[model samples]
Target: MRSLIKIYRATADRVTGRNLDKAAARKQLRILEEIEFVCIGAVAFGLFLEMPSLCSAASLVAFGVLGEFVIHRFHVRASKREQNLSDKESNEQLAAIAEVNLKAETERLKRVEIEERRAPRRLSMEQFNIIESRLRAFAPVEIGVIPTAKGDAEPLEFAADLCVLFRKIGWLPAFATRIDHTIRLGLWVELSPNADRLAQRAAPELVVALRIAGIAVDQDVSRPAGGEFGGTGEEKERACGAGIILNVGLHPVTARGY
Candidate 1:
């Protein structure tokens, strides 16, 4: 049994080596064929369509045939060389396989190795939200805050992260985010690519929420001409400039608004 196991391992290694050699040979041949096909196709198409003079056409055809001959000759030599190499490698694998006994054990170990590999991505949205909340809380916030909302089309995980981030900082109140974009009372905020238009584009529901929170939109916050967001610093000042600002230091937590 022991001897058989040793032989099996040896065979497996040889087989893997031969397979790699075969793949390399096939790749080289494909590259050569592709180059030949493109060059030949282009020359043939041009000769048939554009060359009007018979002497020019004849010379082109003759030169093309000569090129083809050289290419084919090279291919034949390369093919023969690869075939010999492949056969030799395959024989080695076969010899090892014949001398081996524990193919099942080897196969089992290979499967185990693959199974141990880590998955592509780690954190779920809910989990990421928690982390973002923590990070945001630590992030500095001034009178003005960047109110970011992932579009409705964004992935659930991404949305959760954004919300979590918003909650952590002074940007949003605790659990301030909701899955629904509209209020049950028939109020909703408008979704737009441009945040500057929020005052105009935001639905009645969103404006009401901001108003309720004491975040009155400053009409006097003149829009900057050269840039967008209307000088966010000024906007923050406006928010702070209000008679009173709420949730200035409070953590974002969820609460229902009618």
Candidate 2:
């Protein structure tokens, strides 16, 4: 039994980088152990009444406790190993995604490289003035900022609700999907005075929901200045673009913080 506990500790230490959240894990293990002891006691009480061998009943209880301890130790070790593997896989996936993103950026830069090279020296005065006029005519509009980690599910809910809101209210159909850990929502939503308000309110709700669901909410909120648009609309009424989210965890509710 001592050797088994040593093995369990070693396994956990190796897998969790020696930074295991001991408080949380120990709390959970203790709960399980308590439940096991209660069950074993009940069973022994019934057996002892039938057989009248107090010594044997006591030994049986000891065995039950030892068995439970072993199981508890193994369970903790297994969970840590699984978590370690999951973390490793997640890092690998992120690296692959970053590589792909870099390649795409390189391709885009190459396509615009020639145009950028020829841009400055050959431009006539009249052409430059026209470009400047166009730039000035483009109004800079502010969209609400979405803070990453404000809520656990903000990113997903905001994206889903945005897609729906954009399609129905703005009359622009948009697609929403998760790419890696990021949720990407792209489509044209008709610009209106209340668009910012709707986005701001919805974004925070999603973050809260994700936190409740036990999934870490951390991401950047980004919107491009210009995209494809179909028509204009009046700000007749305000609406919400809120998404749904929830929390999930293997740890007991009370032990989650640990």
Total clashing residue pairs per candidate?
A: 16, 15
lDDT of 1 by residue, 1-258 (tens): 456545545544543222346667777777777766765775696577767787777777676666667777767755765776666666566656654535666787888877654222222545444444443433342111222332322223333343444445434432233343321211112222222332232223233444444433332223432222222222332222112111222222213221
Where model 1 places Cα greater than 4 Å from the true spot, the runs are 1-21, 101-258
lDDT for model 1, on a 0 to 1 scale? Answer: 0.41
lDDT of 2 by residue, 1-258 (tens): 334434444443444534445455556556766766765675566465654677777766677667667766766775665576555555555555666676788889897997664442222344334433432222222222221233435344444443333233222223322222323122113222233433333333333432343323332224321221221322221111121121111112222221
RMSD of each: 23.8, 27.4
Deviation from native of the Cα of residue 225 in model 1, angstroms: 99
Kindly report which residue stretches of model 2 are placed more than 4 angstroms away from their true locations once superposed: 1-49, 118-258
